[model samples]
Target: MEGTRRTTLVLLLLACLLFLSLLATANSQLRTDFYKDTCPNVESLVRSAVANKFQQTFATASGTLRLFFHDCFVRGCDASVLLFSPSGKAEKDHPDDLSLAGDAFDTVIKAKAAVDSDPNCRNKVSCADILALATRDVVALSGGPSYAVELGRRDGRISTIAGVQHSLPHPDFSLDKLNTMFTSHGLTQTDMVALSGAHTIGFSHCKAFSKRIYNFSPENPIDPTLDRSYAFQLRTMCPINVDPNIAVGMDPTSPRTFDNAYFKNLRQSKGLFISDQILFNDARSRATVDLFASNNAAFNEAFVAAITKLGRVGVKTGNEGEIRRNCAAIN
Candidate 1:
C-alpha cells in the first residue's frame, strides 16, 4: 500500500510539472514585447498606414476597409494590388466609386511608408510585409470573432486598375445582394455590416452618394422620409454641380473619430453613401445597425470581431505564399 501511494504521488507531481511547462510555453509565445522582437508594431503600423492614406480620402470609414477592398478583391490581399504597371501581376481595371477616381496604391503607399518609418521594421517588417499583415489583420478584426493573424506574407509586383468594377460591391445592391457579395468572398451579411461599421472613421465624396439625395429616379430613389435637417446639410456641400469632385465625409459629425456615429447617422437617414443607407432599409440588418448606434461598446467589440474574421479570408499561410521585400514591386 505504501509503494502504491508513493507512485500515485509521483504521477500527480509529474502531471503538475507538465501543466506548468505548458503554461510557461504559452506565456512566452504570447509575449508581445515589441522592443525585443524585430517584428514591427502591427497595430501602430496599421493605424499609421490607414491614417496616412486616408488623410484626404475615406474619412468616415476606416482606411482599413478600403485596404481590404483593395487587397481581397484582386488576389486575396496578395499585395499585387499595390503594384503599379510593369510588374507581371496586373489587376483587371475595375470601376470603383467615382469619388475614388479608381486610384490604386494610395493605401499601399501609406502602409509601406508607415512601416518604413519604424526602426524595428528593419530586417523584420517591410512594405510588403506590413501590407500583407495589415490587410489580414484589418479584415479579420472587421468580421467575426477576432483571431491572431500570422505574419510573413510576400508582396507582389503588379497592379491593374482593370475589372475593379466587378470586384467592388455595388452601392445599389440590396441586403440579399450585399450578402451574396460578402459570402462570395467567404464572408457573411453579419460581416458586411460589421465591416461597414468601419464607416465610423473616414469620409466620402458627395458624388459617391449624391444620387440618394437629389436624384430620386427609379434606379436611384432617395428615402422620402429622410430627416430634413440632414438633407439640408448634405445639399450645402454637394450641390447640383455636374462634376461633384468635392469630397464630403460620410460621417460629417465625426469625420476623423472612430466611433458609432456612422450608425447614428444611419438612424437619422443621414448615411452619406447609398450602401450605408441600405443598412437601415434592410429588415434583417436594420435592428443590428440601430443596436450598434445606441450601444457603442457593443459596436466596438463587434467591429473588432468582424475585422478579425475578414483578415483570414483566403490567406496564404505556411509556405502557401512568399513574403515580398517591397510592397510596390513583385517578389
Candidate 2:
C-alpha cells in the first residue's frame, strides 16, 4: 500500500509539471493590455453591461461567473461554450452544459454588443476576452474582490457536445477526484479550495445534490457528513418528486455575495454537495477549509490567484484564432 501511494504521488507530480508547462506557454501570450491599442475601452464596456445585467437579475452574477468556469474548464476559456446550434448539437446542448444559467449567455451576448457598439472597439475584441472581463465585473459587482483579467484570447470555432464528457468535475466527486481534476489544470490544492469558493454566489439545482439528502445509501438514507438540521432543511425544500429544476442557493447564507461564506458553510456541514462537504470531512483538505473559513482575506487572495491561472488554460492568442463577429457562431 505504501509503495502504491508513492507511485500515485510521483505520477501526480509529473502531471503537475506537464500542466504547468502548458500554463506557462499560454500565460506568455495573454496580457492585461492586449486590447489597449485595438479596444482601449473594452473593460469599461463589458463592466457597464454586466452591471446592468446584474441589476436586472442577481442571477447575472452567479450565472456569468459559472459560465466563465464552465467555458474555461471545457475548452480553456475560448468562449466555445457560447456557440449555439439550432439543431442542438453544440456544447451548450450537452446535458451538463444545460444546467448553466441562460442569463449567462445573454450576459455575454449583451456585453459583446456593448463592446462592439464602441466605434473604436468594433469587432476588435474577442468574445473570449469579453467573457473574461465580464466575469471579473460580475464578481466585483457581487461584492467580491476586484482583480485584473488578462485578455487577448481568441474565440474557438469548435464546441461539440462530445467535448464535455469527463471534462468537468461532478458534484459527487471526492477530495481525491477534485484534486486530480484541479491539479491537471496546473492548480494546487489551495487553488482548488479557493476556486471552489465561487460557490459563494451560485445556485445548484436540486437534482445535483439530491442523493445526499434522499438516498445516499440504503443504510443511512442521509449522508452522515451533512449537518442534520441542514439536511432536513434541504429535504423540506426539495422533497421527493419535487421538480428537479427547483433551485437553492449553494451558500444558504449570503448567497448573493461573493465571499468566504462558502468555506464557513462547509465547516458547519452545510455544504450543498458531497464534493463540497468532502473538503471538511477529508483530513487532507480540512485544514485549508478551516483557514479559509476563518480568514476572508486569505480566501480572497487565493481566489484571485487561482482564477487568474484558470484564465490561462488552453488560450489561443496571436494569429491562432479568429475574433468572432458572433459569439454564438464562429467567424
Candidate 3:
C-alpha cells in the first residue's frame, strides 16, 4: 500500500509539471491588445502595392518597404511618412514623395517577411506589424542591433506628398544636423549613425546630389573627405549637363552584404554621402562605428540590440492603432 501511494504521488507531480509547461507556452503565444488579429500573407499585398508603383525605379520594392518601417517606428509607427511629396515634403502637391516610393514599398514587404519567419507569430499580423518588424530586420542585416518589436499599430487614412519631403533628413546634412533630425524623431545620435547603415546597401541618383558634386558651392558640395577616385567616378555618371539617377551604394565592396564594411570605408573617407562621413567624424558615434567594424561578434550583437529598440519606438499600443485588411489602400 505504501508503494502504491508513492507511485501516485510521482504521477501527480509529473502531471502538475506538464500543466505548467503548457501554460507557459500559451502565454508566449498570447496576442497583445495592440495587435489586431490578422494573417501573415498581408506582406504580399504591400509588396504588390509598392512594386506596382515603382516597377523599375532606382530603389527596390524591398528596400523601400524597409525604410517605411524604420521611419514610422523611429518615433511612432505612424503612416504619416507615406504621405509625403516629391521633394521629401509631406502633405503637399505631389502628396507622396516619389523618391520614398521605392524605399517605403520595400520596408513593408521585408517587415512582413521578418514577422512571418518568426515561429512565435500566430495572430494575423497587420502591415503596421510588418513595418516595425522590417526595421528590426534591416538594421540587423546592416550589421546593427536587432531589438524587440511591439506590435499593434494602425495605418493612417490620409497620405500627403509634401510630408515625405518635410520629414526625411537631407542627404548632405552634417552630423549635428542629423542629430537634430533624429532626436526630433525620438532617436539618438547613435541610432542615427547605426540606422544610417542602411545606406550601406542602397544607392541614390546623381540628380539627388548633382548640385553639390558639380556646383562650385562649398556649402552643398560633396564632403571633401570622400575618396578622390570614387568622387571622380560619381562625376562621370553625373556630368555637368546631364544629371541622371545613378546608383552609388554605400557598400562598394559588397552592396548586398550587411556588414561593418560601411564603418571600415568611413575611416578611409569612402563614405558616399556627407551624412555617412559625419558619423565617423563625431566622437560619440566614431567609437561605436569602429567597434562594429573591428569586432564582428560585437557588431552583430549591438546591431540587433539597437534595431530592436528602433522597432518599438513611438508604437501605438492597446487599441491605439488598427490592423489594415489591405496594406496598400486606406481602410
Clashes of each: 47, 0, 56
* CA shift of 154, model 3, Å: 2.6
C-alpha positional error of residue 255 in candidate 2 after TM-score superposition, expressed in Å: 0.6
Give the top-scoring candidate (TM-score). Answer: 2
**What tens digits encode model 1's per-residue C-alpha lDDT throughout 20-39?**
67534423332224224665
Off by over 4 Å in 3: 1-62, 73-75, 80-96, 101-124, 135-148, 216-223
lDDT-based ranking, best first?
2, 1, 3
Across 98-182, the per-residue lDDT of candidate 2 in tens digits comes to: 9999899999999999998999999899999999999999999988989999988999999999998898999999989999988
Candidate 1 minimal-lDDT segment of 10 residues: 26-35
Pick by lDDT: which candidate is best? 2
Give the higher-lDDT candidate: 1 or 2.
2
